[model samples]
Target chain A: MQERKRTEIATLGEFGLIKHLTEGIELKNESSKYGVGDDAAVLSYPDKQVLVTTDLLMEGVHFDLTYVPLKHLGYKAAIVNISDIYAMNGSPKQMIISVAVSKKFCIEDMEELYAGIQIACEEHNVDIVGGDTSSSLTGLAISITCIGEADKDKVVYRNGAKETDLICVSGDLGAAYMGLQLLEREKAVLRGEKEVQPDFSGKEYLLERQLKPEARKDIIEKLAQMNILPTSMMDISDGLSSELMHICTQSKVGCRVYEEHIPIDYQTAVMAEEFNMNLTTCALNGGEDYELLFTVPISEHEKIAEMEGVKMIGHITKQDLGCALITRDGQEFELKAQGWNALSEKNN
Target chain B: MQERKRTEIATLGEFGLIKHLTEGIELKNESSKYGVGDDAAVLSYPDKQVLVTTDLLMEGVHFDLTYVPLKHLGYKAAIVNISDIYAMNGSPKQMIISVAVSKKFCIEDMEELYAGIQIACEEHNVDIVGGDTSSSLTGLAISITCIGEADKDKVVYRNGAKETDLICVSGDLGAAYMGLQLLEREKAVLRGEKEVQPDFSGKEYLLERQLKPEARKDIIEKLAQMNILPTSMMDISDGLSSELMHICTQSKVGCRVYEEHIPIDYQTAVMAEEFNMNLTTCALNGGEDYELLFTVPISEHEKIAEMEGVKMIGHITKQDLGCALITRDGQEFELKAQGWNALSEKNN
Candidate 1:
């Protein structure tokens, strides 16, 4: 918490505000022919297949600003869309952002958000081509459309998995879900109190996982360097069980995931225990990990096992076999998709 | 309005609702490689330069649901994005839509919205590539991103206007603004009463202009057929005066527009008189026209004059003359940007 001077956004008009925020931005991608200050952004994807993905984050629905810093919110929002590009085995090139905010926000607040977005774009080598900024009647709303490029034959789809393909995932899961739980607890503790800071000494990893998660760009690069083309690929955003089901349904196949082999961080396990929840269930259905999940031919199993930060947790099965989880006790159970459903949540 | 069945959105869930809305939407453009049911939409533009643009429409700030039907809202949202592509001298090829809605909306309501989107896409020959749908805490929020393609040398930008270039606009101005005024007046009349329909006889054109606007695709096609290229172009979303200012400021040039030449429909003039508002002011500052305002070489003035649906209002001037409007009574006034400012409105 730092005391700073706030400048009203009304001081600068809409065009003036857009110009002020995007003034110093320079296009860094060759595909980006024209950046801001135009009716539409011009791009040139001469020989590559263009990829487009969009995400909308709404206040109180997708996020709670009470515990989420504005910078981290911006960072996470960009990461969410970028992750979708990588999920299709593409290199992100340009982004168009549109935001609507109430008068509660000032120019400085917007600067912080754009700073986070700039950091993410610079790191990923994506250009901020164009965006629209306007006033909203309620809290903040952000909608981002990310464009990427992939070779004609390199793009992967979820319907490519076949029987006997090995299922693998990069990095561990459930940490981000654990982080959210901890944040909610801390927010509740400080609800009616003033000057009493909540303790979060050893749970820093959880908070970082929730607030500032990064897209799995390195994993995409590593797979390319290893020359391993996945049969099917997607990023794990809505929990492993839900995404796996999508692959199974689309590919017309089934899978058997090993409960014992599911990746879980130590911090996530500790937090799940403290909350008296099942760690395995958390790993399977707790989402927002932004980890790459894919399947390759079983012949490449040895190479996949050798790759650092990746783990083989299952294998594709025939359509009649059904998707299941093989427990450590040798019992098999159907995997239910209990992932977070924003629409369904409204009914409750 | 006819009575229709409404299904609860929660029953279908997010993914199910998306699948239901986007089912049977085949890709219509050759550039659209893969669409819907994937992490990202895939497109290919081998020789054409790609154009991208986005717009965010927030409830209450952008539209009033009480007076606007869901179908018209969706249609306008799509057109607003598509118009930007046409403004760039490109043909729209693909679109990605993201919407956030409160629980008050039902599955049938979304279908009506998507039906309008489908009609717009089909008419433009653009493909509905992909979209994200989530629940909002309040009213509806829509964000649409349109992708288009044009020849390498044909893309137009606002900064390309040069000295002595003739300024022209497609269709009529101020009708849409007048339509909005009529809708608001009717809404106020019916505020506390039921079954008392506010009469809008002899004003159907204005109502249509505000509810459903079409981009000037015909003008672009006609220009191409005539082998004419505008030096600069942009769609009129934020009033003619404000958009003209952008062209002048970006091109580092000035212009003199004749008030007598400004195009106005007969209906708009009558409505202006009824509202007791200045007719020229309404024509100059009224926004959401969605018409193409552009500058072509003076050498082609003869061909332009022969062109139907286009009115030549003025010509670009040297940077020293400044942007001004010459009245019919032989008076000159520096044009001011009194366009609708959503951000400024928040302060009031």
Candidate 2:
């Protein structure tokens, strides 16, 4: 490996640093008429409804720098917002990222973070249009706002689901949550031993799910090709149970999800067993999966069943039925959202 | 005053708290088709271009709570972002506010902050659309993104100034910076003396300017009514001299601003004299005025002079001339940007 060069941010000042960081950025989206260096980014989206979503991630609260690489942190931050845009069945076109870092970070650290952000934008064909960078008193803080566009008639909302709509989910769940657990356990063990290495053999999938999850743009493209528009949709960041509750409450309906139909990767299942946890419980309530959970008309169930990476989990029901899960033994129980609640767990 | 009710944020959880805070937010912009309670906010500006800007405010680095009230902090945070939209000569339509607070804040504390934000939004005709709230490990963090719209041909940029164009400013300068100095002095004095109240009896204008600065939307509207499109425009958040340098550098031009032409309020001059500082220096380099700075063709000088609160202070010059200020004593001096560079000042 080559030696890396470092520069102090103070030398360039705020304006100079911003200019340096965004020097070679090329706007890929036609909608991005003007980007950095302007008072505000100028965009044009003719005849389309624009979608906007924002997410804020703080150090110590959202990630542990001891285990999370700055590049991965940057990538995950952008993807998280992009996933929200995708959840509305919109295509992300531009993003504005604001970051605040303490003196502990050098210019090289910011470069690595921006590199990761650029990679994610390039992969999604999105434009890095504008941002604000400042200094924090303690740790790094990142906030991303993604702008997307969709045809006015095709955008999906959480309140559009109807009774008898088939519930579907793309990809597997709980891997990211289990990956977080694995990293935490390793961090704890390494605290006592100087030379101990994390034992991550055969668990790259879980780690990837946690460190580098991608938004389900391919799934959305496939759905469009299949001529299926989800009645309602949302991304699963706060666990399946929690997101399901949001859709149900917004649509004024309930759902019946089958425990066996919930997809779980082998590594997640093995890790659950090692930790003496129920696989079904983790699949239902573990968060940070970044998977698409949506409801389609029951009449299109056959078409969805033929698609790859999508599973038919259950069906929507009237409000009186409540959100519940039918177990393998045919026992029905009300689902509780045990996802991370920042206010109740950390602030209060 | 009636006693206010207090509630713990933990009791309502994150979702419930978001609902409570945004309970009656009504979208008044035609571009805002959908707001809050969705994966993303939906907007449409079919025949116009959209402008977006973001700003981040971190505790300790940006504001000191000992002297800055939470309501004022929240209001300033929103105005700062809105100012950027006006700087682009666009009409702000919507904003998304994201805040991260520590355990020390109660539900009522958040209510106060939101009230300030709501007031700003209502006054500006901008709707609160979508945002994310999380818990921080330490002090408060606020990030606001403002979305605005303008006709593609009417949007002004900082690189359009031409030689001989008359530079103009809306309102006076240095009052906000002087106000900040006063507050800092009072905070230092009150640290050791328990009974000393800040003697702000005659300095109400300075305190209000510092605590509740407003974006110059009125200036933009008036300029439109006058049919005088500025060649280049930007808000004076980082002092007149610094922002002038930005315009000069970007437009490949230089400027000669007359010392006597710079506008300074009476309170600002008195405060500078009391502090043994040069009034001209404060007017040139003191920041956070939230005033509009623009240049118009020399032919429109008479019209600009007739407008209320408008002052012509300078004229654009060739790049070879360099950016300078002609003092009242018949001497010229180069301008330096002494604006707030948080990275160098606080973190370093």
Candidate 3:
């Protein structure tokens, strides 16, 4: 053996590291048509069509231990990752979980975490196919990748939203955000005056909306049953304004959402008022609700209106029209694209 | 609005958590035939073979910051993850990488990490498809699920090894472990006991092997050229013994390895002696070599020997015969299955 110099990883840029690592990888499976370069990796089983997507959840940034229950956290992790598949109009079939925990966690703790994961899997009827468990030096990390299948003709892409499409959202907006606000406030109250029991009694729905957000899997099924194909679909994670902006950008169109029509849950509305915050602000900028935000052809508007839990909020327009919001006061305003930039910001 | 009780994830085990989290998931696409319940999730793409495999690397367990360069670390992340797919006799197409970083780090440091990842991707000719990024309070984590493809007939699993199959390893073992020893030595010298400019000049190969190991993509290519289908295959990640055990367990057979046949690079051999450790132990238990450990039927032995960089280390036997190692000194010893357990202890 001869001595050779090795360069450190820091010397390479992010792009450089990825290039060097994946080079010379040859795909020999006829079933793996695409890998590693798209929004989702594409895999073809012998008898099925599937799109795969994965994401990682880090403690602190994605959730807080102070208020989040381990079970809810587990459930939320599954919903978030599965949402990506649903965004593509795919039926989620299975998921693979990987977790790294610190020694501070015991087997009992891990069991709790998996219980939440199992609950989500069962609700969705997906199996806990495979996973890797490792011990970390600090905190906890969870990575999940989900596979979903859709008919070739029914699968929708973020680019499919067209001008004149009706933009809709299942369930109300901003409830999750309001719930988070209340949680933060309660934490502050406990930390400061040590007075009041957080007064969460009246905020059950909003709190549940935040702690255990669902992926709107039912809505996806409903759409299929009604023979409706969304022009574009995405989960409302980073607030309505931000998600709406994403739809506009990805679809190369503009959107106009009516303020009065923007559905706000009753509990979220009450809580926002109690907190002395604008109801619209909470709805527009709150992230992590996991509700489905999608667009449909205008011809289906009447049909959608008759469906339960579905609300029509806006319409798509030509690119030059730009994204806007018609306020309750009859004032029109431009929609900003900024959401929670988790990386650049310190405080949420 | 009413306050609801917070659920603690610790109450649910990892399995329970997984179940809870996956509830209510609906599959909308016909393409998603399978998800979350098998060794690997299945995706169906037209006219393409399926890609698959997984790995999760935790901080502190896999590397020591005192010696590993960030660039090498990043590249190694991709290399290790992709090795799983390779072990399955599949061509890696792309990878989805998800990382959990602590708040102590900045974007610049992350970019440094990604730089190494980029370099690795380029070398492997893989695309930087999609991944998730988030922050942790401390310690960094990376989970990679690789998508790959192989002709149905060419794919190999651990269960395929049979009686009389020749067990082989590509390149060498124990070098990476020795490299770690040398680097630790140099690090100790630099930390204290002045004037000890360590004689690290001649130890570069071992260090690089430890720090920036490469996956056996070349051997995979060669196997295709020679039209060889391995009876069983796996990457030498947790050491040779551990991998062999996987094959033995899965194939329901035993193995017999000859001590004299195991290959050890010159530098690794010397380092093993200097450390007052048996060179054989290093070869058997030292990990992270990232080489291919595979089995072939006796009929293919001659053809395998003709290939470059392939070395036969052992042979498979009937289950009742059991796994054993015949030492060069004519001492026969029973082989036990043991290696680093990620959920328990990582010797590194």
Candidate 4:
């Protein structure tokens, strides 16, 4: 391997590093009045409602740096928050990122991370308004806050799902989780091995799903163009089952999702069969899909059914019915929030 | 001895813990249209400019939990960001907080931290808009984003200082730094001691200054009431010398601050003498003051001079003069940026 040049972060210090990283970052949004080089960034939203969402990603718990690149980590961190904004029927306008890294990281590592963040921002047309960088004692920690804008009447909340609303989900699930499993297995297989590359042929999609998941920005834009405003919506980061339960609990309405309707890619099904894992369970409980889960009025069911990349999986029910999943075998099973909980004993 | 009840955070899970901690949070600001329990918090800033600032505090780096209580840490974290908004001459209206913790922490610990954040929010009339909570691998990490509102023409930036501008700072400095020193010494003295209390009778002010520093909200209000708007402003979190240098550099100007005019509390002076540290150096370079450092036109000097707890320390000069500090004996020394660099070798 060729030796890569390494620059000590201390050579630039805190202020110098911030200046170097944020230099020439021009604001693209009209709402971004002023950015960086100040105590605070100034934004103007004269006629729109501002939406704010934040996420925190910690090392070891949220990610493992052994196989994950710093750039992808940065991209995922920004995408998660941006997804939340889109889930709210809003357009992300600006982002503020805060990162704390240990001494093990070099300036080039941070550059790669920033480059990834910049790519995500450019793709979404969101401006990098401001951020804070500091030293950590152990591993890297990232916290991102996304600011978005929407019309007052266009914003969707989880509590708006009414009875009989059609439940819809964009794209597919289980791929990201399967990708994680594949990476973990490969890491174990390659442990202590020398001069041998792990065979991941034909699993590129799974790896991409796990390493670089995209937010459902297109789905949101399509909904807007179709004049379909979701009664309730949220991004599926904590698995489909967990998010469905949140929507039900918040909306005071239960749901009935059909297992056959849950979309899963061909790769995900094959991987589940190979791993001997339940495909439906993986589709329901696998998290980090970044897909949009939403409910719309029944009157718009035909419109949503015809929308590409979207699946009509369920319908909202009265609260007394309770949330349930109708299995393919004509059995009804109550939905349990078996999603990955960050504070659960398993994570610890 | 009393035994404190400790409950594992895993018992409540991430969602449960967040709901429990933020159960009764009521939005007090009209700008906060919706808060918590959603994909994103909605804010309506119909006519005012929005200000955003963020900070990241890490364990064993930005703070020492060995001596600093979690509640104080939470309070200080919120206040630091709030101070940034005030530095821009804005009124903080909402805050988003994200915390990552390790298995060592319990649910009760999080409650204490939230309680501190609640208290600060209540004091400042800022609403707890939204946040993220997750588990960390090692120590606790906190990131807070404060959003504020300001009139379009009233917002201030660091680059607005012009030649002949009068530099002013609110209240005294170095007390927080002295408090940190006192806490460190006492921690060292009380290490491994059983049931022995550290003697901090007369130094209570310093401890409070360090552990529970308040943002200069009153100073901002006073300036507004006096009809004086700062040409340039920023909080003195990174020491007066460092922050002054930032303003001078950004504004393309130089400054001449008098060392004798720098404010210092009596307790700080006494502590510096006891520690055999330079008092002037502490006043100039000791950070975490949370005080407002601002500059106004020379014509507003008379109004600022009459303002209580506010000191006129210097005047802006032409860019070629360079930033300098005049001693009590009229000796001129170029100002140096000696503020704590989180990425420096000393920190590592």
Q: What is the C-alpha DockQ of each candidate?
A: 0.78, 0.77, 0.19, 0.90
Q: In model 3, how large is the Cα lDDT of residue B276?
A: 97
True contacts kept of each: 0.84, 0.81, 0.38, 0.89
- Our tally of clashes for model 2 stands at 0
Residues A1-348, candidate 2, lDDT per residue (tens digit)? 578787887877777777778789999888999998878999999889999999889898888999999899889988998999999999999999888988888888988898888889988888999977888989999989999999999999999889999999999999999999999889988996776678799999999999999999999999999999999999999899999999999999999999999999999999999989899988888899999999999999899989999999999999999999999999999989888677766433
The superposed Cα distance between candidate 2 and the true structure at residue B150, in angstroms, equals 0.6
Residues B267-310, candidate 4, lDDT per residue (tens digit)? Answer: 99999999999999998999999999999999997898899999
On DockQ, the leading prediction is 4
Estimate candidate 2's alpha-carbon lDDT, on a 0 to 1 scale: 0.91
Worst 10 residues of 1 chain A by lDDT: A339-348
Evaluation by DockQ, superior candidate among 2 and 3: 2
Residue lDDT tens for model 2, B130-212: 86678899999998999999999999999999999999999999999999899988988789777567789889999999999
- Two-chain DockQ for model 2: 0.77
Q: Chain A TM-scores, one per candidate?
A: 0.98, 0.97, 0.84, 0.98
Span of ten consecutive residues with least summed lDDT in model 4 chain A: A193-202
- Candidate 3 residues B8-50, lDDT tens each? 3333322233334333333333323444321123355555556
For candidate 1, lDDT tens digit of each residue in A208-241?
9899999999999999999999999999888999
Model 4, residue A242: C-alpha shift (Å)? 0.4
TM-score of chain B of each: 0.98, 0.97, 0.84, 0.99
Write candidate 3's Cα lDDT for A95-210 as tens digits. 66777766565555555677787778777765444466665677777888776666757667666789999999888888888888888888877875643566689789989998
Error of 4 at A226 (Å): 0.8
Ranking by TM-score: 4, 1, 2, 3
